[model samples]
Every structure is written in C-alpha cells, then in structure tokens.
Target: MKINEFIQKYRTVTKLVPGLTSSHTPHVICNDGFEMSVQAGQSLYSEPRDVADSYEEAEVGFPSAEESLLTPYAEDEENLCG
Candidate 1:
C-alpha cells in the first residue's frame, strides 16, 4: 500500500508517543498492539508488510530446525575425541 494511504487510514487512531531525542521520530501504537514510527515530512507505509517481507527473507535464508539437527559436522567428531 502507498505511504499516504497508510497514514490516512491510521492517523486518527494512532497516538503520538514521547520521542527520546530532538530529531526522534514520532511513534504510534495501533489497536492491535503494533507500534511504528512516522517520519517527518514523509509518507509512512504499512509496517506489517515490512515485517512479513523480513520473515519471508529469513525463511529462505535459514534452514529448518529438523534439517539442521539431522546434518552432521566434522566438529562433532573433534568434540567427541576431546
């Protein structure tokens, strides 16, 4: 979704929280407990989409726990000998 559209939809519902520094961006906590920062003089987009993209990237880059456990390493023999 476009940044303007996202801001328009949530602007009314979001409340501004105290910023840590002079240039610190304003943050809003959504009804669902999601928090996001709004950049000054710029449109802000949906954070959920960004989070989803990160998860998708992680899923592709990392192996499953079961697969990792099934794999053997040369270090295993070295550790056993010690």
Candidate 2:
C-alpha cells in the first residue's frame, strides 16, 4: 500500500531513527506491533509486513537492558569511557 495509505491505516508506535534519514525514508513501528518502511520514492510500502521481533532488526540496538545508567565504574566498556 502507499505510504500515505499506511499512515491512515495504522498509528505510529515509534520512529526507528532520529537522524536525517528518518525524515525522508522513515522506518517505523506501527501500533499493531508490526514494522514498515517507506518505499517506492517514499510513496509506497511493501506488502506482507512482519511483526517487530527485535530491536537489532531495526538497527535500534540499545547498549544495555538496565533501566538506569548508574552502573559500577568497572562495568563501563573501555571504548565508552573517556
């Protein structure tokens, strides 16, 4: 279906990327717990969409599952440390 039509059919759960690419060719999760991306010159979407399985599939990989960032100093990865 067309991107506009898809928007009309489903409520957006969350936008995948916050960067510039998100504005033009957005990859989004819909309220029904499925994922879809803009296609065909930002006009249409492919059919047979799938339920969002993991954040990794969407490139929304988060660092830690912990609720808080306040972790022991030793737990910090060297690359993440100054």
Candidate 3:
C-alpha cells in the first residue's frame, strides 16, 4: 500500500486499541493479527518482522547510526549552520 494510505489505515485501527499514549511508540495489532510498533507520528508501510501473540511481543528496531543522521527528517547543513 502507498505510504499515505498506510498512514490513514493505521490511524483508523489504532483508535480501537486501548491505552495508547502519545509520549511513546504504540504497539498496534494489525488486521492480520500480527503486531508491529508504530511511531507516534510515522506510518508502517512494510510488513514488520517479529510478530507474536500480542503487541507487546513486537520488537522495536532502530535505524543505523548513518541512517539516523541522514534521514530526510534530520536537520540539514544549512539549518545546522544557522
């Protein structure tokens, strides 16, 4: 599915889950019963690995150091220099 479509779907499903907080990532139960971690403001566009019986079973993975530093959301050189 497209990223925007995925984001919309995620928002819909998450509303049904209870006790989700905005301060941290939420563990979402997909329609397929596989659980995945969804960052508060981001969407999961791909199938996540490490599915289990519950959302708590889903593991959160972090990007590599290089990826973290170079992400499109990261501050650019111009912003950093200012």
Report the Cα lDDT for candidate 1. 0.31
**Every candidate's lDDT:** 0.31, 0.33, 0.35
Q: What does candidate 1's lDDT look like per residue over 1-82, in tens digits?
A: 4444444454442324443212222344445654445432212232333222121111011122223432352234334222
lDDT per residue as tens, model 2, 1-82: 5445544444334345552122233455545554434332211232323222121122121233332332332244543222
- What is the Å distance of residue 1 in model 3 from its true position? 1.6
Give the winner by TM-score: 2 or 3: 3
What ranking emerges by lDDT with the best candidate at the front? 3, 2, 1
Clashes of 3: 0
Each prediction's TM-score versus the true structure: 0.21, 0.22, 0.23
Worst 10 residues of 3 by lDDT: 49-58
Give the range of the ten consecutive residues with the poorest summed lDDT in model 1.
53-62
Best candidate per lDDT, number?
3
